[model samples]
Target: MVDSLSELMIILNRTYKEGNVFKKVVKQIPEVEAAKIGEISKRISKAKQTVFEATAHLDRQVWQETKTSAQQGRIAAEATRKTAHDIRARVIDLQQETSEGHDKLSSQVDQFRSQMVDAADQMGDQLAQTKRQITKDGEERKQFEAGLQRLVDALPASIHEQLQSALYQFVADAIVQRQLFALPSNIISPNSPPLPLVQYAQVLSESDIINLLQTPDPIGDADRILRKESLMSDEALGYATLLRQKRQFKEWLSSDWPSLVLVDGCSRGESVGRTSPMSFFTASFASTLIRAETGIVLQFFCGHHIDPQKENSGPKGLLRSIISQLILYPKSYNLSLNFVDQGLYDAVAASNTEALCYFFEKLFWQIQPDTIIYVLIDSVSDFESDLHDYGERMDRVLILFQTLIGQVLQGFAAGPKLKLFMTSPNRSHRLIYRVDQAKESIRLNAAALGDISRSGERSLREIRRARSPLSYIM
Candidate 1:
C-alpha cells in the first residue's frame, strides 16, 4: 500500500508540472526587442506622411465647417468668357464697317481718277503755252510743237500712274513733297471700337448693309459673295502658332542646317529631318526677303475642293512630304493649294477641349504658317445635327462650340503670329447669320432671301422650276 501511494503521488506531480507549464505559456505573449524596434522605425518617414495626411484631412474638415469660398473660383474664367464673346462680336461689327469703308475708298479712287483725267485737259493747255513761249525760230518752234504733240499722245490712263510720274517731275523740279491724304485711325485699326457679338447685334441693321452697298463701285455682272466665318458654329477649334522662328532659322542656316536636318519621329535626338528640312530651307531661303529678290509665289490653291469624307491627313502628309522633297532639292517652289483644314472642323468634334488644345499646340508650331484659313461649306440638303432642325440653332450645341472656340482663341492669343481665317460651313445656315440677339443677318443676307426650295435644293433651277406660283423669287 505504501509503494502504490508513492507511485500515485509521483504520477500526480508529473501531470501537474506539464499541464501548469502549458497553461502559463498559452496565457501570456513572449516579448520581442527586434519587433519593438521595427514598429518604432515605422514612425520615421512613411508614418510622417500618414500623420501629415491625417492632419490635412482634419484641417480641411475644420475649414469646411468654418469658412466660405464659393465665389473665388471660376471668377477669371467667367470674365474671360465674357470678354471673348464681347470681342468676337465687336470684331464682326468693326469688320463689316471696315468692309464698307473699303467699298467707299474704292469708289473714291474712281472719282479721283476722273478728276485726274479732267486735269489732263488743263495740263495740255499749259503745255501748249509753254511750247509757244520756249520757241525761238521756225526750226525751234517745229521741234517744240512736236514735243507737245508727243506729250498729248503719252497721257496716262490711270490717276495713280499720272500721280507717280507727276511726283517724279516734282522731285526733278526740286519741289518739297508732302502726302495729300492722312487716313483716319479707324481706317488703320482693324481691332478698334471692338464690340462683342451682343454689342454688335444691338446696333447692326439692314440699313447698314444698304448704306455700305451705296459706295462707288465697279460694274460687274456677277453679284459678289462676301466671305465670312461663323465663330459660334465651330465645335472644335484648332490654332497653329509659331513664334518669330525666322531668327532661329537664321541661326540654324549659319550652322549649315546641322540642327535643322532631323530624320526621326519618336526617337529623334536633336536632329532635323533632312528631306523636309532641306526643301523648307531651299524654298524659304529663296523666298525670304533677305536680299534684293522676293522668293515666294502669290498664288494659292485658295479654293475649297477637299473631299469631306477624307480625313485630310493623307493629303496633308503628302503635301508635307512633297514640300520636304522640294527642300531636299533646291528649285523654284510654289504651293498651288494650301491644305487648310487647319483645325476648326476637328476641334468642333473633339470630345473635350484638352484634345483640341493639344492638337493645335503641335500643329501651330509645325506648319509655321503666316496666314491661317478656315473653310466651311453649307448645303441646304446637308444633314443637320441630330439635336436641331435644319433651320434652327440649338443653344446647347452653341454653348459647346463656344467653349471650343474660347479654348482655341486662347491658344491663338498666346501666339499672335497666327491670324485666324474662318468660313461659315453653309450660306443656308441662317441660324448662324440672321440678325437677332442670336443671329447677325449682315454677315449673311441669304437668310433674308427666305427659303426658295421647300425640298432644300438651293440651286437656281430649283427656284425657276418651282411647281407653285408663290415659289418665284428674285
Candidate 2:
C-alpha cells in the first residue's frame, strides 16, 4: 500500500512539472508575439512616415500645379481681354465706315435727284418753245394757203383746169423721178398743198443730169475716152493744156451775159477722129460743173452712133435732154405759172426738131432772171455729118444756139444768164469758123502739146532725182 501511494505522488509531481512547462511555453509564445508585434509596429511607423513624406511631396506637387494652372488662367484671361478689346475696336471702326458710306450714298442720291429735276425743267421749257414755234408756223402756213387759194380762184376755169392737170403731172413726174433716182422724198411734205410747184421746186435740189438723160453713163464714157486716148495722166502736156482751158471755161462761166466757148479739136491739125482729148475734156468739165451745184447744167453727149431713134446722140436728143434738164431745174416759178403751154408738151412728146426749138425758145424765156444756165454740147462734129445736108443741119443747129445767144446779148432784163460750151472737130470748117466767132476759143495742136509734155517729163525727172536716196546720200 505505501509503494502505490509513492508512485501516485511521483505521477502527481510530473503532471505539475508538465503544467509549469506549458505555462512557460505559453509565456515565451506571448514574448515572441510581442517582439514580432514590436517589429511590425516599427515597420508600420516607417511605412506611415514614408507615406506622410510622400503625401507632403504630393501636396507640394499639387500646390505647384494649382499655382501653374492659376498663372496660365491669368495669362489666358489677359489674352482674352486683349482679344475682346480688339474686337470692340474693330466693331467701332466698321460702324464708323458704314456710317460714312451711308452718308456718301445719301448725298449722291440727293445730287442725282436734283439733276433729274433740272433736266425735267429744261425738257419742259424746250417742249413749250417747240409748241409755240409749231403754232406760229401753222398761222403762217394758213395765211400763205389763203393767198394761194385767192390767186387760184381768180384764174379762168379752162386755164385753172390746165394748170391743175399740169401741176398734177409735174408732181407725179417729180415723185417718180425721185423714186427712180433713190432721191430723198423728205422735201415733199405730206401736209403741204399738192399744187405748190414753186415751193416744191425750192425744196428740191437739182440732182444728177443722168436722171433725165437715161443715156449710157456719160462720166464712165468720158473716163473711157480719156483712157483710150492715153490722156488720163495729169502730168501729160495735153492734159495740162486742157486744164488751163477748163480754168478759162470756168472764168467764162462767171460772165453775167450769155457767152459761147468753142473748142475746136481739129485746130491741132489732126483728122476728124471719133475720140479726142477735147471731147473728154468737155465731158469731164461738164460733169464737174454739174457737180458744182451752182447752176442748171444741161449736157448732151453725142455718142458715135447717130441713130435718130437714139435721141441722146442727135440734135433731137440734144433738145430733148436740155428740155428735160430744164424741167428738173430748181427755177420753177415761171414754169409753174405758164405750165399750160400744150405746144411745149406736144413738142417734147413728139420729139419734133422745129417744135423742140420753139419749145426751147419759149422755155428759155421762162427761166427766172439771175439764174445761170449752162449748155454743154460735146462732139458736135458727130451731128449727122455723114448725111448729104450735114452742113445745112449743123448750120440750123448753130443758128438756133446763136439766136438764143443773141437774145441773151440783147440784155433782156428779165432773162437768165446763158453760157454755151461746144466741142467740135475741124471736119466742118464752116461750122468751126462759126464757132470761132464766139467770145472764147481754145485751139489745141500736137506740137505745142508735145513741147509741154517734154517739159513736164523733165520737171518730173528732176523732182524724182531730188527725192532719190542716192541724191540725199550724195
Candidate 3:
C-alpha cells in the first residue's frame, strides 16, 4: 500500500509538472517558499485523486469501444457471407434457366427449319406451275398472231392500201393537232417540218405499203419503227405563234405606213424587246412586209443559219432576194422598163451588200413617193459581236452606211428616203449612240417617249449607283 501511494505521488507530481503555469507560480514563491511548497504538496494529493478517477473512466470507455467494435466487425462479416451465398444461389438459378432456354431455342430452330423446307418446296411447285402457264400463254399468243397475219395476207392489195392510207392520215392529223396545242403560239415555229412523226405515217402513206404487204420483212419493219421513234423531237411550238405573229403584223402595217419606219428591238440580251429573239421576229416581220408589198423590204438577217463570222455580214440569200426583185421590176427602181424582161442587172456585180449599196440607194430614191422602203436588218449585234477588236468591223460598216445614206439623201432631192433602222443590245454600245445622235432619229410618239425617258433615267440612276466607274469602261 505504501509503494502504491509512492507511485501515485509520482503520477500526481508529473501531472502537476505538465501544467506549466501552476508549476511556475508555485516555484516563484521566494518570500513564502516553505508555505508554497506545502500548498504544492496539497495540490499533488488532489491531482493524484483526480488522476485515479480519470484513469478509471478512461479504462471503462476503452473497454466499451473495443467490445462495440468487435460486435460491429462480426455483424459486417456475417452480412458479407450471407450476401455472397445469395449471389451464388442466383448464379446457379440463372445457369439452369439459361440451359432450359437454350433447349427451347434449339427445339424452335428445328421447327423453323422444317417450316422453311416446306415453304421452299411449295414455292418451287408454284414457280414451276407459273412458268408452265407462261409458256402456254406465249404459245397461244404466237398462234393467234400467226392466224391474224394469215388473214391480213388474204386481204385484197387495194383494200390494204386504202386502209393503210386512211390509218396514216388519221395518225398524221392527230399528231399535228396535238403538237399545235402543246405550247403557246408565241413560242413555237410556224415553218418547221410537220412532226417527224409524219415520216412514220409516211411509211404507211407512201406508195410502198403494198411492198410492205408483199415482203413482210420483219427486220426492215423493225428498223423503220426504230427510226421513226428516234426521229428528232418537236423543237418549237407552232400554230398559235404563227397566228399571233400574223395578227401583230396586220396591226403594225395599219398603224405605221408611208413613213420610213425602223423595227429596232432585235437583241437576244435586251429584255426590253420581245421575248422572242430577233431571228424569230425578223421572219414574221419579213413575211408581213412581203405580203404587204408596200415597198421593197430589203432584209439583211445576218447569222441566221451560220455562225457569226466576218464573212457572214450579208448572206447570199439576201443578195439573191434583192437581185431577183431588181430583175423582176427594174421599172420600180427607175431603171428602163426594158431592163425588167432582159434581167439586165449584173448579178456578179450585185453579189454583196457593199456592191449592191449603190443600187439600193438608187432603188430607195426611185420608190413611189408614197411607198416607204423598210430596211429590216435584224440582230446586227450578232455580227458585230463576232467582229472582235471591240466592234471595229461594225464601226467601219456604220460609217460606210452613214456616208452612203448622206449621199443618197443629197441625190434624191425628191422623196422616199431609206428608213435607216438598226438595233444594239443596250445603250452602252457605240451603235446605239451613233444612231441616237442622228438628226432625224426615229422619234418615239410623245407619250411613249416620256415613259421611256423616265424609265431610262431611273434605270441609269440605279445602274450608276450600283456599278463602279471602272466597270463602265468594260
Candidate 4:
C-alpha cells in the first residue's frame, strides 16, 4: 500500500512541475502582444513624421513664390515713372524754341517801319522845290511874247514874206526841234474882175479857200488831183491867208482910217517888163491897208509873173487890159467942192509918170479921212524903168503933192500927214534914191533894208520831229 502511495506522489509532483511551465508560457504570450502593439505605434509615428516634412516643404515653396511676385511688381512701377519724366522734359524744350522764334519776327517788323518814314520825308522836299521853279520860268516867257507881237506889227507890208518867214523860224528855234512842214503847192487865179482895182475875191470866201485846199472834190471828175488831199487840208495852210487879211480899210470911217498899211507882192502881169511900178494908185492902195491899233488894213500880194506872154509871165493875161478897166470907170465928183486940178489928170498913157502921179493925187484929194495915210510898198524892183523918163515928169512924179500940201497947209492951218514904205528884194537891188532937197525927208535906201536869212538846216530837222499838237496836247 505504501509503495503505491509513494508512486502517486512522485507522479503528482511531475505534473505540478509541468503546470508551472504552462503558466510561464502564458505570461510570455502577454509580453509578445505588448511588443506587437509597440511596433504598430512606431510605424504610425513614421507616417506622421513624413506628413509633417511634406507640409513644411510646401510652406517654404509658397513663401518663395509670393516674395518673387512682389519684387516683379516693384520693378514694373519704377519703369512707368521713368517714361513719364522723359515725356515732360521734351515738352518743356519745344515751348522754349517757339518763344525764341516769335522774338526774331518782331524785330524785323520794327526795322521796316523806320525805312518807310524816311522815304516819305524825302518825297515832300522834292515837291516843294519844283513848285518854285515853275513860277519863275512863267514870268520870263510872258514878257518875251509881248515884245515879239509889237515888233512884227511894225514891219512894212512890202517885205512881209521874207519877214514872216524869218519870224516863223525864230519861233521854231525856241519851241521845237524839227521843220518838216506842208506848203501850198497850187494857187489858181483868173483874169476877170469888176474894176481895174480888183477888189478882194467876192465869190471865193475864206471858208471856200480853206475847203479848196482841204478835200477838193470836183463834181463828176474821175481824174486824180495835183496834190494829195491831206497835204492841202486843214493840217497845213488851208485857212492861214484868211487870218492875215482881217482889216478892210475901205469900210473905215474918217476917224477910223488906217495910218499904216502893208502889202505882199506888187502886180502879177506882163506890164512890169517896160516900167517897174514904184508908186501905187491911191484908191486901190486904200483897199489893202491895216493899222495895228485901228482902221482896216489889208495885205495884197501881186505875184512876180507879169503875164504869160512876158518874160516873167505872172499868173496869166496882160496888165494893160487890167489897167484899162480902172481908167474907163467914169469920174463922179463935184468940181466946185473938189480940186479940178489939185490931184486930177485927164491924160491916159501906159508908160507916163506925170499922168500916173496926177491920177494918184486926184484919188487921194477926194477922200478926207481922220487917220494919217501910210503907204507900204513891197518892192521897187517890180516898177517899170521907162515910166520915170524926164525931169519935169520926175519932179511931179516924185514930189507932186508937196505944192498941194503947201496950199492945204495955209488954208487949213495944218497939212494932211502921209508916210511911205518902199521895200526891196535882194540886198543889192537899188529901190530908193534922193528924190528932192530934203535929206531928212524920208526914203527907204536899198542899203538900209534888213537882210534876213533862212534858218539852219539842223534846226529844221529837230522841229520836224516834234510830235503833233493834235495827237497828245489837245
Candidate 5:
C-alpha cells in the first residue's frame, strides 16, 4: 500500500505544472487582441482629418464670392446718383434761357409799335401840305388867265387910239394937201344923200361871201375872170372892184399895216404896160409926202405879170410873199418891233386874214405915236379876171375896213382925219361912188401917172415920150 501512494503523488505534481502554463498562455492572448484594436483606431482618426480639411476649403471660396458681388452693387448706385444730378442742372439752364428770350421779344414789339405810330403821323402831315400846295397853284393860274384876257381886250383899243393921235399930229404938221379926185356930177353930187353906200355891192351880206368861199369848187381862171355871165348878171359890173378893195384893206389891217407898202395893178388884158397908174401916182405922192415927214414909211408891192392869164400872176400870192419877206428881215432896224420871242413874227406872217387882224391890233399899239400911215390900193378890179370871184373876195375886206375906220374915228374927239384912196381898172366900179363921200372918181390913164410924177416940171410932149405902160411908169 506504501508504494502505491508514492506513485500517485508524483503524477499529481506533474499535472499541476501543466495547468500553470495554460493559464499563462490565456493571459498573453488577451494582450495581443487589445494591441490590434489600438492600431485600427489610429487609421480611422487619419481619415476624419482629411475630410475636415476639404470641407474648410469649400466654405472659404463661398465667402469670397459673396463679398465681391456686394461691392459691385454699391458702385452702380453711386454712378446713378451722379447722372441724376447732371440732368437736373441742365433743366434749370433751359428754363432761364427761355425766360430771357421771351422778355427780349416783348421789348422789340413795343419799339415796333412806336415807330408805326410816328410814320402814320408823318403821312398825315404830308397829305395836308400837298393839298395846300395844290390850292395855291390853282389860285395863281386863275389870276394869270384873267390878266391874259385883259391884255387881249386892250390890244385893239390901244392901237386905234394911237393911230388917231398920229393922224391928228400929221394934219397939223402937213403943209401941202393932196386931195382925191373931185367927184363927177353924173355919178355923185355934193348934196346927194349917201345912197346906202353898201348898195354898190350886189351881195352885201357877209354870209353870202362866206357861203361862196365854203363851196368846194376849183378856183379856175373862169372863176377869176370877168366873164359874160358876170357882166350880164343882175350885179353891177363895178361890184368886183369894190369887192377887191374890201379884201385888200382887211388883209392890210391884219398885217399890222406894214411900214413898207406895195400898190399894184392886177389887170387881165394888156391895158398899157405892167406898171399900175395908182402905184405910179402913189410913189410920186409918197416921195413928196416923205419930204415933209421924217417918220413916214412907204413901200411898193408889184405883181409879176400885168396879164392875169399868165401863170402864177395873182395879186394874192404876191401880197403874201411880201409879208413873208418882212417877217424874215433881220431886226437890224432901230424902230423894228421885237418879234424874237414866242415865234411872233413867223406866226403873224403865216396867219390868215382873221388872225392877221388880231396880230396887227396888238402890234400897232406898240408903234411910236407920231408915225403916219398912207395906204393906196390900185386896180382893185385886176385882182381876178372873174368879176364874181373878185366881188366875193372883197366883201369880207370891206367889213373889216369899216370896223377899223369907225374905231379910229371914235378914238378922236374931232374924228381922226384918216383918208383911204383906191383905183380901179374899170370905170364901171360902183364901189368908188358908194365909198367916197368926200372924193370923186378920176379916170387915171397911163399918161395921168406921168403928169403926177412931173407935173409943172416937164413939157407934155416930153412927158408923153417918157411915159411907158402904167407898170413901167412906176
Candidate 6:
C-alpha cells in the first residue's frame, strides 16, 4: 500500500511539468506573429519598387521611339522639298531649251524660204530668156526657108529640077535621122520587157545608174562614185600626161581603125607603181579622153574584194554600165531610140549575161558607121573574186573582149569603130598573158610610164579644182 502511494505522486509531478511547457509555447505566439508581419511588409515594399522601376523603363523607351520617329519625319519632309525644287528647275530648263530650239528652227525656215524665193525668181527669168531666144530662132529659120524657096523658084528649069531633087533627098534624110533619134516607145511589150526605154529614161532621171545596175559604185578615197578628187594620184597624172605626148598613144587616139590597147603595169618590177597608181593612171587617162570630146567615153572601174554579187566586178556589170551610159549619151541629141530593139531591151530588163552579150553585139553592129566608141575598163585583175569558179568567170570576160575585137576585125569594112582600153596590175600575169594574145592590142608597160613617181605630187584639192567642168570648157 505504501509503494502505490509513491507512484501516484510521481505522475502528478510529471503532469505539472507538461502544463508548464504548454504555457511557455502560448507566451511565444505573439512575438512569432510580430516577426512574420515585419517580413511580409518588407516583401510588399520590394514588390512596389520593382513595379515602379518597370513602368519607368517602359516610359523611357516610348519617349525615345517618339523622338526618333519625329526626327525621321523631319528628314523625309526636307528630302521631299529638295526633290520638288530640283524637278521645278529641270522643267524650267527644258522649257527654255525647247523655246530656243523652236526659235532656231523658225529662223532656218525663214532663211530657206528666202533662198527658195530667190531661186524661183532666177528660174523664171531664165525661162523667159529661153523663150525669147526660141522665138528668135524660129523667125530666123522661117526667113531662111522662105529665101531658099524663092531662090529655087528663080532658078532655070533644068537646074531647078536638079535642085528640087537634091532638096527632096535632103528632106528625106533629115526625116530618117529624126525617126532614128525618137524614143523606143514602139518596142515596149507587156510581158517580156519589164521596163521600157521610156520608163527606163524616167528612172535614170530620178535614180543613179548604179542603182539600176544593182551594183555598188566603185569605192574611192572619199566617195563611192569616181569623182575628180578620188580619180587620180599625182604620179598617175604625170604618167598620163607623159603617155599623151607619146607618138604611139597619139596614134591610137587619132586612129580611124578599131583597136584594143592593153596597158600592162605587170611587165615592170614591183617598184613601178603597179597597184592603185595603175588604177589612177587609167582613170586619169579616161578623164582626158572624155575632155577631148573625140567620141563617147564609157568607163568601168572594176572593184576588188566585192561581196555578195561579185560578178558585178566582172564583164556583166561592164556591159550593163556601158549600155546604160550609151542610152544617156549625147544628152542634147534629139534622136528617137531606134537602136534598142525589143530583143536588146528584153535582155537588159532580164539582166541575163549571155543575152546581154548577144544584144550588145547586135547594138554594136547597129551603131552609126564611122562613129567612134571608147571603152575604158580599169583593173582587169579585179574581175577575180573568192568565187570557186572565178577562173572560168574571168575567162568568160576575156572571151567576151576577144569576141568583140574579133568581130570588129572581121567587119573592118562596116560597123562603128570601137577602141577598148584596159589596165591591169602587176600580180595578174594570167590576165596580162590573155590580153597579150590579141593581135591588135597595143601593150604599154610601166617602162612606158617612165619614172612618173618621181614627178611632183599635187594635192587632191588641186587635182579636183583642175579637173572641174569649167576647166574642161576653158
TM-score leader? 6
> Which regions of candidate 6 are displaced past 4 Å?
1-167, 170-250, 267-275, 310-312, 331-347, 384-413, 436-474
Q: Per-residue CA lDDT of candidate 6, range 390-444, in tens?
A: 5555566566656655555686335567888776654564565665444434444
Find the 10 residues in a row with the least total lDDT in model 2: 465-474
> Residue 39 of model 6: what lDDT?
61
Q: For residues 1-474, could you state the per-residue lDDT of candidate 5 as single tens digits?
A: 234345445434443545465222333334544554454456556666867887788778777877887788788888889889999998899899989989989999999999999999999999999999999999999999999778757789878688779999898555212111111222221221221222222322323222322322111221222122222221222222222234443353234322212222232232324333333433433444444553332233222223445322333323332233223323322222332223333333343343334333333333333344444445555553454244433433443434445444455211112234455544424344335332233332333333232322333233234331112222
Off by over 4 Å in 3: 1-31, 158-474
lDDT of 4 at 189: 12
lDDT of 2 at 287: 56
lDDT of each: 0.32, 0.60, 0.45, 0.35, 0.40, 0.58
RMSD of each: 34.9, 32.3, 28.5, 42.6, 41.8, 27.3
- Against the correct fold, how does model 6 do in TM-score? 0.46
Instruction: Report the alpha-carbon TM-score of model 5 versus the true structure.
Output: 0.32
- How high is each candidate's TM-score? 0.19, 0.45, 0.32, 0.25, 0.32, 0.46
**Residue 95 lDDT, candidate 2, scale 0-100:** 100
Q: Which digits, one per residue and each the tens of the lDDT, describe model 1 over residues 112-167?
A: 99999989989999999887776646668789899977876687558557777998
Candidate 2, 326: how far from true, in Å?
2.1
The reply for model 1, stretches above 4 Å from the true place, is 1-71, 133-474
Q: Which should have the higher TM-score, number 1 or number 2?
A: 2
Shift of residue 355 alpha carbon in model 1, Å: 84
Give the Cα error of residue 41 in candidate 2, in Å.
99
Model 4: worst 10 consecutive residues (lDDT sum): 218-227
